[model samples]
Target: MTQVIRAYVGSLLGFLLLDALWLGFIAKDNYTQAMEGLMRDKVHIWPWIVFYTLYCMAMVYLVIRPQFNAEKASGVFIGGGVLGAAAYGAYNMTNYALLADWPLGISLQDWVWGAVVTSLSSYCGWRLARR
Candidate 1:
């Protein structure tokens, strides 16, 4: 529906901007790369960030009815984000299984980091909804 697309697209862009800004303060180096739109090792987090944010915002927006309130959306977004993190963990396991010799360390810790990044992004999406 029109509203669904609006919320989805709006959440994604809003998160992209806010995350970049949020990271700007907490992570100056990453913020620089994000601002420049460069593809560096640091920028690798972007994919996971964007993915989780999109999933949470979209899920919340789609589920809530005609007029989505920020509070309800935030709750749903958090739930969606947690689910996304779990999904990301599973995905990493599958990916590592496919690539036995991944240059980067193939461990549960790495997978956990992926989940952290996803959770953070989802949080950002929720924050944006409230604004």
Candidate 2:
């Protein structure tokens, strides 16, 4: 239980930090330009909280726990990368398909970012759990 908690915390923190960098700085201009009129002037706080919480929970349960249990060091990152790719791909592809204004560039960028960020976060979670 303690290990799980530790893993979750580490994963959440890592994810938040990396995502903050991506959304707040690195990809800000791209997102603003891509989203255009669709973005809210003031962001909603609750959705972010809920998303981060649930996403990290899924990461822990589906990726971290199994890797940790199996003592597989590399699987955490690989699994996380795969998971991120799948999740982000689904969302981005859906938007591209449904939304006329959705850009393929944005979807591609997000897929890459998601894979990198989630891979690192999963590694962090595994590290914390191991200790």
Candidate 3:
């Protein structure tokens, strides 16, 4: 139970930090240009909180726990990337398909970001849990 909590906290922190960097600095221009008229001036806080909570829980359960149990960092990295890519791809691809103005470049960039972030976070979580 303690290990699970440690891994969850570690992964959540890692995810938040990396996502902040991506949204605030790295991909800000891309997202702004892509979302232009589609974005709200102010994002609602509750939905995002819910999303992060659920997403992190899924990551901890599906990626971090297995890697911790197996004591294999590679499992965490690979599984996390795959899971993240699939999850993000579902959202992005669906938007691209349904929304006329959804940018393909944005979707691609987000997919990459999601996979990389998930892999790194999962590794961090696994390492923290092992300690």
Candidate 4:
């Protein structure tokens, strides 16, 4: 029970930090251009809050826990990356398929970022929880 709490908190922090870096510094321009008119003038906080909460939970449960249980750090990292790629790719690809004028560039970049960020975050969380 304690492990689960620690994992959730650690992964949440990790995910937020990494995502902030990616969204705020690295891919800000790309998102702005891609979203263009599709974006709301004012950012809505609720959806993002919900997204991160759910995402971190899923990351910890589905990716980190199994690896932690198996005592495999490498597996945590690799599985996190794969899971991130698959999850984000599903969202992006579905948007591209369903939404008119969705930018392929944004989707591709997001897929890459998702894999990298999730891998690092999950690893950090697993390490912290293990300690």
Candidate 5:
């Protein structure tokens, strides 16, 4: 139980840190704008992001690598990322369904980016576990 709790916290912290690292490095290091963006309703699914991600990861970990600990967290992250991408795709679809506007190839792009980052985060956690 302690281990699972530890795993959850460890994974969450690592995920947040990694998210910040990339957001800072490439997204012009702008939090104010991000805050503003999250505060809106058009793309205002901000509250769902954290819990949804961790939950997806947890599902992935429990299913795929129950023994890998930190490494398992990576799988969870990738799982969660895939979930996130699907969500964005779904959100766009629902909004533009009437207009018939789809993201087409952009969904692929999000998938790639999300997978890469999530994998990196999971890998970092796995390596940190050193077992």
Candidate 6:
């Protein structure tokens, strides 16, 4: 139980920090240009709150816990990256299929970013759980 909590906390913090840096600074202009009219003028807070909460839980439970117990450090990073790819791919592909002008480049970039971010975040979770 305690380990679960630690993993969740660590994963959430790492994910949020890395994502914030990417969205708020690194790729802000790119995303703004890519999303353009699709984006809301004002940020919606609730959806993000819910997404982060549930996503962190899933990351900790599905990726971190099993890998941590198995003592496979590599598994956590690999599994997390795969999970991120699948999740982000689903969302991006869906948008590409449904939306009129979704940018393939942005989707590709997001897929890579998701994998990298989730891999590192999973490492953070595993480290905390192991302690």
Candidate 5 lDDT tens digits, 1-131: 44444445555566677666755575433433434433346645577586547643653364224445433354555654565456545654454464443343433544455555555554444443443
How accurate locally is residue 16 in candidate 6, as Cα lDDT from 0 to 100? 96
lDDT of 6 at 96: 88
Q: What is every candidate's alpha-carbon RMSD to the true fold?
A: 7.2, 1.2, 1.0, 1.2, 6.0, 1.0
Model 4 segments beyond 4 Å from truth?
69-72
User: Compared with the true structure, what per-residue lDDT tens digits does model 6 show for residues 28-100?
Assistant: 9999999898898888999989998998898998899888677668999898999899888898889888999
When sorted by lDDT, best at the front, the candidate numbers are 2, 6, 3, 4, 1, 5
Worst 10 residues of 2 by lDDT: 67-76
- lDDT per residue for candidate 2 within 6-59, as digits (tens), equals 999999999999999999999999989988977888989999899899989989
TM-score for each of the candidates = 0.44, 0.95, 0.96, 0.94, 0.48, 0.96
Off by over 4 Å in 1: 1-6, 14-67, 70-74, 103-110, 123-131
lDDT comparison, 4 vs 6, better candidate: 6
The sequence of per-residue lDDT tens digits that candidate 4 reaches over residues 1-131 is 78877888888899999899888988899899888978888899999899889988898899888877675688988988998999899999999999998889999999888898889888878977787
Across 1-131, the per-residue lDDT of candidate 3 in tens digits comes to 99998898888889999999999999999999989989998889998788788888888999988777684588899998998999899999999999999999999999998899989988878888888
Show the colliding residue pairs in model 3.
Answer: none
By summed lDDT, the worst window of 10 consecutive residues in model 4 runs over 64-73
> What TM-score does model 3 achieve against the real structure?
0.96
Note the clash tally of each candidate.
Answer: 0, 0, 0, 0, 2, 0
For model 1, state the Cα shift of residue 56 in Å.
6.7
lDDT of 2: 0.91
